[model samples]
Target: MSVADIKKHLYKAIEEIDDEAFLQAVYTIISSKMGPGATYELSADQLQILEDRREKYLKGEGKSYTWDEVKDRIRKKDGL
Candidate 1:
């Protein structure tokens, strides 16, 4: 279906929703989507690890592989 059709169906469904708690939850979800993109809450240690790996990659110290090489290795291991 088209976007307009989906919106019409959503509006009708929303109107029929009468539970206050459910409505509040749905409102919170829709509002979150309408605002800036969703965010991730990462721990300090996890963030540090990611930053360290990125730095190594930028410095050309990280191991890399081509797509074909990766597929060949997977195929070999799987005996495909």
Candidate 2:
């Protein structure tokens, strides 16, 4: 879809949402992208770490979990 169409749909969807926390999270994300300081620069070490992880994952040597799995692990750890 076009950017304009996507934005129009987002506006309508956001208007229908009644959850304050969900709206706040959306607002936070939007503001971070829209505001100054939105452009992030990774330090040399941080970039190297990310590159290393990507290489490992591409080689099938890095373990990964789905969002549901991570949530389940967190809940189990917290006894929630």
Candidate 3:
């Protein structure tokens, strides 16, 4: 599917999910886009990290975080 198609389907799916799942899915996508940087645009270090992570992921050596982990991290950073 095209990127647009995938995004559309993702949006549709999230709209039907419970609040927690939706937040988690959104966080996962946003985090992946963030990589090792503060901006959506990748920095050199972030680009290298992404490339290495992709390679590790393809080889089943990558890691992942749960939705709760991300939510809590953000909350703490913002003093929520």
Candidate 4:
């Protein structure tokens, strides 16, 4: 079957799940299969840009938002 077919079946299976313990186990299995977070090596230019942004933030030249505020704004913007 195609990836789309597999995804549709997976979605249906997820929706039909009723046992909380089984569902949690399924989540753990999927998380393990997906492995760890991604890693990237930044180039010198990218690193410099990030450093500049950090310096600006330290100097209070840019605004910072709390995680909750950011998530709320994102959810509202996306109509989630």
Q: Which numbered prediction scores highest in TM-score against the true structure? A: 2
* Candidate maximizing lDDT: 2
Question: Root-mean-square deviation of each candidate, in angstroms?
Answer: 8.2, 11.9, 15.2, 14.0
- TM per candidate comes to 0.48, 0.52, 0.34, 0.50
Write one digit per residue (lDDT tens) for candidate 3, span 8-72: 99889878878997688788888888767654576899999899999998898897779999999
**What is the number of backbone collisions in each predicted candidate, taken in the order shown?**
0, 0, 0, 0
**Candidate 1 Cα errors over 4 Å, as ranges:** 4-41
lDDT of 2 by residue, 4-66 (tens): 999999999999999999999998899787878675679999999999999999999999999
Write one digit per residue (lDDT tens) for candidate 4, span 1-80.
99999999999999998999999998788877775753346899999999999999999997899999999999999998
User: Candidate 2: lDDT over CA atoms?
Assistant: 0.94
- Please identify which of the two predictions, 1 or 2, would achieve the higher TM-score against the true structure: 2
The weakest ten consecutive residues by lDDT in model 4 span 32-41
Quantify all predictions' global Cα lDDT against the true fold.
Answer: 0.90, 0.94, 0.86, 0.90
lDDT string for model 1 (1-80, tens) is 99999999989999998999999998788878876744456899999999999999999998888999999999999998
Can you tell me which runs of candidate 2 are displaced by over 4 Å? 1-37
lDDT of 3 at 73: 91
Q: Compare candidates 2 and 3 on lDDT and give the better one.
A: 2
